[model samples]
Target: MGIRDFADYLGISDRAISNWEAGGESYRPRAASQSVLDTGLARAPDEARARFADALGVSGPGPSAAAEMSVDSHKFLPVFIGSDRAHRLRTQMTGETPPDWLESCSAIVAHPHAPTCTLHVFACGVVVFHILQPRKPASLTELAVWRYRSYASDLPWARAKIHDLLGEHHPHGPNPEYVLSLYWLTAGPWIGSQYDTAMRLLSTPSVLVDRSAPGGPVPLDGAVEESLLATGFDHPDIVSFGVRGVSTGYAGWSGVSYAALSQERSLTVEELVSCELIVQALWCYTHHIQQRIEEGSDPSTPDRYGWRFLRAANSRLTTARAQETAQHCLMREAIMRTSGLAERLRAAQEALRESMG
Candidate 1:
């Protein structure tokens, strides 16, 4: 349920409930509020408080608050082997143990308002939360509109400070989760490559999401990309710019494959750490792509069998110095935009203050 529904049940304003969900404010529910949720849900007090805090984005009132908030629920999902649920779910779902740091994982905090539900795990003193959001197809018109708006919003600020400082904007897909789900798939080289390639693909506003039909592996030159590009999607290969790019495609597949993977395992500490690097790589690739696209060049290979060309293109984009330069440019542009807007806004505020005086 959304925050408003919970607030109404508790005789509080929606904002109050929102604050509790977001936490860290003076209004963050303390012991008393924890009691209300516990008694209302008839669940374990700790689980309830943790859920409350999680739904609100707060760390509940520590262990004591959890002690008071316990209750029980009858629903049960089969405990599978090699899964975190086989261990923690019974305790959490039954309100037996104090909730682990899963409720407070960084994935949840970073993507607090994501539409899809998430699963979090705590191992070795680190929290790794997996985010799962459904992916949808985009029409070419949708792509154009998305590209226009994304470029408009991101480029204005980018232009105010540094050149080539474009932001990644998805006009036609699901909402941009604050922390994109790059950690959900296989970790290591696959993750790294996908991270790097997604950045490169984003540079040209290409449709990076794969939507082949449900039959045998869908054709790469299918309707989805054509629909997104309005023209035949010019590329070296249908899958991974051709077979060589499959490693790159593997990364994209992993980034968007949280659902299939979620059923198999919980997010690990190493995965989260790797995801940060992957995302940074993505940001750098996107910036580089944006710069080239703005100048009317395709960042991916021109021919379908152009792995060598794509590889060289990929190499130029992944060098540490290149990535760092792109980051500096984006940050510099953001600062300049902030400063300019602050100046104008301050002037307007001063004029009002003087008029009132």
Candidate 2:
């Protein structure tokens, strides 16, 4: 029935029915009036019933409607870390225990059924700990255990690689390149892509040198120049190695330089372990930033600990663009799911009306 007909049938004014149909906050029907309309709709003609259902935003049968709902209707998982580990690390670093809240962050990583994305966020927390308190690098080991315990079945190879790396001893020190390769293997495809892209951006010649001087080459700091050289790009022509210019030879050179020169490999085995930990931590940091962006949180917002580790890593790799890309990807998935759900609902409602008729 039309709104006017329904209003007359329910003993209400047409304007009141119009207000209910419009769904304006100021004109919400009382429970009795709403129940009266529901009863009328329940007994109405098929076409009129469908029309009223549409006006009321009732898409289809409740069960079917719920089944077709999108990810937008579900809450995203929160980023979590091990509170006990975080507190222990904090205590080790500061010679005092952390606050209660800081010590009470959920131990999401240890939970066997935690989502993979949540585990990634926990990995980032481990990285943050490594950066903020290098003296307490045990978090990385804990992260490895968490990852293995939580995802061993799905990511068996990654867990195996972690075991091999941690269990085996390297006399010459674990090659930074080798450690990084393992990280890429375990980090999943998207994170590996982000790391490669970030590395390429850092290695760009224009980024390394002064832009204004076409003739005169800018002198880079010794370490910066060394790192660039290690990437196999000649000083002035480094721009030739664009975003997709990653190479194994360059990786080896860079890895060795990072391990030997940057980290100073004295105890070879420990140095290798340290190299793996550092690379994994950096990747985790990148993932953390991406997770924050997807959660609709401000990526740059200051936190309790001021995100010292994230800031330090970003200073070197500049994860802003990569994080933006991740955010866009998440939004696209949500939009696609929403669109799909709407289409499915429309189809289901049409089918329902056809069956009713």
Candidate 3:
């Protein structure tokens, strides 16, 4: 049985089980040898032995208490703060409880199964404990535990990013939006590659925004949209990976742009649209050439088909001399066909002029 079940059977706390598993004491299935039972088994020995055997689901007698028990410290670490927090909080809970590592920060945020304390580590590897206050609901620890599992299984670089992110600062307050964004920037590839994991992260507390707050920044709707779009563009194989879902990585990016756009000198939609068109044209032309190069032939190699297609596409686009002529022609024709659009444009111009006055 696991240490948790054993702890329940012995009527001891899980921490105590951790401590026992660490060293100072030893425990065994009571139904060992008849001689050792008389020596080591504590209190109402026969009854305790039967209870222990029943609790462990073992029918027959096991080894004596005198038999060497392998109490692994490494194994106990994961059970305590979990694999993610183990390396971070090890000294505070188990190893040499360093004086420098102790810092009075917060209260114990206990999981039903295992209590946890958050700590910061200094450059010298000294840990400073800042226990988190318990949440009213039990899901807080469950969330942490789930993240612990997910984050632990990440690539080494991704794990480092998660550690750096969580360890950096919490005093800035409940900025889950920011945290989620950082994860995207640093560990997005891993999260995006898996649909379920990416969706789970999105549903977490950090990504969700409070809409009712007055004077808050523009909602993260755009960033969320963009993120999901990026994921779809990059990882269409999420379904083949046994996860079926679509997600956006755009929300996080749009969230970041909130502060900038809210400030003075933001670009108008027309300007933005123009910029997007240019970028799109560039991307199409670049990708066409890149795909040809990536497929087989080198750029240095003369490709009759590629060069011919490229020249034709380039010829259709305007030269510097034709730019004004082309614009004049299009505007004259558009004015003749779309008088309503011209009226709306005039109204928008008048509104802007009136607002400035």
Candidate 4:
């Protein structure tokens, strides 16, 4: 959209728009004007939004026909710190008790630096940090691009935060990597059969976003669904975990993502977040065991969190309770498979069992 056209679309004067643009990156939009800009972006046509996002040099929302979807981003950073270290760290943290699912397995603490960040210290010698960033993205492609672009900063932030949280208790700490991500899609633009397509693309953003671009990430094409519909798209990492139309989700290696679409009943955000916590914690736990085996060492932990704990965790993850909703089970399994937790759990269980012998 041209300057005057965009100004008129926003129902604002051209000179004001010019001033804002002339101010460029340094220009901070007035606090009150932020809502106005947000409203304008929300009401703008998909085509115009795409153009705007492209001009900003980022992967944009979906194609012209695709509706804008609201997504709140969640980042999971998991690392192993050993059971003894986790116990010592908990004494330094002032946080609430964890939920029922994680109460026995892990200790939940708030990240001191970032309000939106929380740290989960598991008894199994792994810690997962949960960072929440609310976003109104046009498409999963935008999220994929946003995630990678910020990863450089996110990793360093996690490392520093860990050191601060652990204090001088331990001089050595394991490096934490980007374990996974989740998007609680509050409002979806797709309908009926389109849910499958959205879930598929959500699992694999590389399909539309080009992450290897010169400057930063950009969209591969203006239209995603059209191209996907033509040839059909699927990824081994993508796992569908919801019924059609009602509630749909996809879990992939990068993250577990879900959208609540049920009219009769909707799954709570707390429910989804809790599931992600379990998935991420388990992924971290298994990664520690895997790392030990690779280093040619027998995994060892306190008696309570030894081979028996792995067996119990495996059952907790692989088994589905009757009271839980189908969506819950589907999402859990999807995350498990995508993270390769099941395989790792099995291997860990066997290795630890042999150690016991």
- lDDT agreement with native, every candidate: 0.30, 0.31, 0.29, 0.68
Off by over 4 Å in 4: 1-67, 96-115, 168-172, 191-195, 212-218, 223-226, 229-231
Candidate 3 — worst ten consecutive residues by lDDT sum?
71-80
349 in model 1: Cα distance from truth in Å? Answer: 46
The alpha-carbon lDDT assigned to residue 294 of candidate 2 equals 65
**Deviating ranges (above 4 Å) for candidate 1:** 1-107, 110-113, 116-132, 137-231, 235-357
Error of 2 at 163 (Å): 18
Per-residue lDDT for 303 in model 1? 36
Candidate 2 lDDT by residue in tens digits, 174-267: 1221112211111111122333332332223234444345543443344553453345334322221110111111122112111111111111
lDDT of 3 by residue, 32-123 (tens): 22222222222334566457546544422111111221110000010111223434544344333235211211123222232443333322
- In model 2, what is the error at residue 239, expressed in angstroms? 15
Sort every candidate by TM-score, greatest first.
4, 2, 1, 3
Which digits, one per residue and each the tens of the lDDT, describe model 4 over residues 242-315?
A: 54334567887776667665434345667877777777777777777777888999877677776777788888
Model 2: lDDT equals 0.31
Give the range where candidate 2 is weakest over 10 consecutive residues by summed lDDT: 241-250
Q: Deviation in angstroms for 178 in model 4?
A: 2.1
lDDT score, residue 287, model 1?
39
